[model samples]
Target: MMRFHISYLACAAAIIGAALTAAPTAAAHQTTHQTRHQTTRLVFPGQSIQRAVDAAQPGDTVLVTPGTYRESVTVSTPGLTLRGTGRETVIEPGTTKAADSCAEHGNGICVLGTKDRDVEGVTVASLTVRNFTGTGVFAMATDGLTVRNVTAVNNGVWGIAQERSVRGLFVKNTARDNGDAGLFLANTIKEEAGAADTQGTVVEHNRLEGNRIGITVRRLRNLTVAENHLTGNCAGVFVVGDENKPRAGALTVRDNTVADNNKSCPATARLEALQGSGIVLTGTEDTLVTGNHVTGNAGTSSLSGGIVLFKSFVGTPGERNRITDNTLEGNAPADLVDTDTGHDNTFTGNACTASRPAGLC
Candidate 1:
């Protein structure tokens, strides 16, 4: 592949400049008539946010006032809005952990839906959840689930996570200092299966730092990650897949600033040691990677690069993906590294300084 020295940064701006949909707040879910008698449940300091949430009806709003509350919250009802007074509302582990399934599972907040029924249209917004042994906010089997403006820090596995869900929107959130990926979206975490279509789930405008990976989109399809800031993680964004029947791909990573993700994380049971990786695609196909700014990420690990098309841990090769119109610089090893050959991957119209095998700048 012959490398071209073209700056499509200006052209990329014109193409990706269309404004996205205005994010809607949880309180705006109901119409005027439906909200005429909207119930408002309040939780004060020293009170339980969970108590208020449990007492609320489907359309009710559980609003927690500013204070530190040490308890895990579980929301099972549909169409409920759980809001806090911004960052002033803090939730951490309680002294004697709640015996509820959520707390027992080590999660800060749980939105539960059974396999037979999905909790629909529930929203969690504007709070801080930290110091949990498990996820900051976790959801399963939901539709139209929105988690916005939540600050998730220092969690064990994931900051904000979801599985077996659809049409979920995660925007304007901050996830930092997590043990694993700051934001994790997957078909299911418990088993190996074909990829699930997310029906256009969106992750946008979030800041991710100090995590194993900023965001991990695993075994899912039809999702979009855009306009996010990622730094201080071992890897910026990982689009991961394996030998599952329907390969994970058909997603978009666009218009994001990913820089200096040079934190060194030892290899996990399933993955290699990682550092300074910008956007990585493994065992996936037909993905569109465009209009991203990846800079100053440098490391010696095999996975390290500005943009990497790697064979999966299970040795599934990526195929037919487009790596285009990105801006990259100062990435050691290479600005673009394609580890698999004859896979029909294309690298075109990017402004970068170096590449591993010579022509993919």
Candidate 2:
């Protein structure tokens, strides 16, 4: 396995133009009016966030005040808005242990949708979620789910994870110091449980740092990851397919800044073996990687590059994946690496300082 030590000196000059502050807290909504079908529930620090969640009816708003609340919150109700009124509103693992099901799933705040009761149209915003055993925010099998303007830090696994959900939005969030991918979106297509693939999922304007992967998309469709700052991680962005499912298509990774992602973490052999790269596409199809600043993600091996297109045993072959219109520079070993199994993947109109598998530039 290739071990990595995190460093940002190489990309110091590169990151000058990037945003350096936390996501704007003032953008948080003060109060939202209840709809005809919904009501609003208010809670304070002493009252558990989950208490309001349980008491909430469909389309209800659960607004929390500014304070630290140590608890594991799960949302099973649909059309609910669980929002923090202030930036200081925090949710940490209070009595929840790693042995619990919520902690095992790495979900500090989980939105689980069942066949009888799907948690659709749920919004969670303007909160800090940290020190949880699992993902800071986890949503599954929901439609029209929105998570915005939140900070997720120092979690055990993925910072924000969404699976088997459609039409979801994740914006203006900061995710750092996580064990796995900072933002992970995966759709599990299982016959027994009626799990379906996700579509129209948007991730934008987020800062992802110091994680195994800045952002990860697996087996998703019609997804967009744009305008995000990805730095100081093991790998910047990874888009791959699950071996058991059909490959993901219609994906876009655009207009993002990815730099200096070189951190060490424990992983499966295949993941651990991969070199540091700004973006990696394994067994994906019909994907676009464009208009991004990819720089200074250089590892010791030839595998480290600005962008990588490769075939893996875990999924389908990478075909028709376009790598275009990007500024790629200062990557070690080579700027671009494409393995033999990658077929019909094009690299055109890319402005790069260096490249491998020659002639792609």
Candidate 3:
């Protein structure tokens, strides 16, 4: 009798523990369903965008209908998706010269301006954010952020600026005619004297045009920039190392169509003589510039080239880079210029022609 009683007690204790573990999981599943499915559609017919973002919760969808929203929007919640109805959904400042004059200095849309990891997994899609005094869409110190099918034009600075440890998808966005670079990515190093590492970013299938620099990557690693059309910018792409950090590594620039950039006018009364190039790689290492069509770069006084590898500082020269399979043509003098003080950078299979090469059609 005593043995049977002890066995029964052991079985009862095991059952109770199992029940305790399963209870919390059931509650969590119910919470997830409540958060994700609870969506709110926001129509902005002369209303403010700030109001709609304030009313959103985690895992909620804010569907913005087709209209003009003349206020800045910031997303501080995690798992929130703000999607526009169509391309006509515009987000700009209320004033006319608000962007250029810096009268209203705010981002059109933002995810986590403050340094908090709580605001992750935010997505902004299918909107036209233009003419903002600051960045068009700024993602700072956030992870798993996605910006898709958005058009950002004529901003004072970068169209999309990702800073300080942001890992995300930026796809099918068009950034054009901005004053600075179209897209700027710098890992969230503080302005103080320290180094912060930004890594594992994918920038693909976008159009960057008419900006001072098409795309600029600073102090980054494990980055892939591919299949984008960079045209009519001062320089098609500029990759530089932060002098403070000096450890920018392993960028892949592949299969991009970089053409008609480096347009130079004569030195005006107010301005000095200007020049640009197709690709400017400065103080970077282990970069692959391959299979790109770079053409039509012109300079006013000097000659522009297809690729300019410039050595910025007096360290180990930018080495171990590969430039291969690119069709380089229509620049002034040569196709490639290596002004680097360092050595051992290889250039192979680059076809240069005075006219358009074959298979560019």
In terms of lDDT, the best-performing candidate is 1
Q: For this target, which candidate reaches the highest TM-score against the unseen true structure?
A: 1
> How does model 1 score by TM-score?
0.90
Off by over 4 Å in 2: 1-38, 96-106, 115-117, 189-197, 242-245, 266-270, 273-275, 301-303
lDDT of 2 by residue, 250-280 (tens): 7899999999887755557556544467888
Clashing residue pairs in candidate 3 are 164-188
Which lDDT value does model 2 have at 350?
93
For every candidate in turn, the CA RMSD to the true structure comes to 12.3, 11.0, 13.6
Residue 12 displacement (Å), model 3 = 55
How far out, in Å, is residue 58 in model 1? 1.3
> Model 1 over residues 1-361: C-alpha lDDT tens digits?
0111012222222223422123223331321112347665555566678777877888887776667889999999999999886888899988895789989988999998999999999999999999999999999999999999999999998999999999999999999999999999999978999899999999999999999999999999999999999999999999998889899999999999999999999998988899999999999988999999999898999989999989888888888999999999988788999896537899999999899779887
* Clash count, predicted structure 2: 2
In model 3, which range of ten residues has the least summed lDDT? 24-33
Which pairs, if any, clash in model 2? 106-134, 106-135
How much does candidate 3 score in TM-score?
0.78
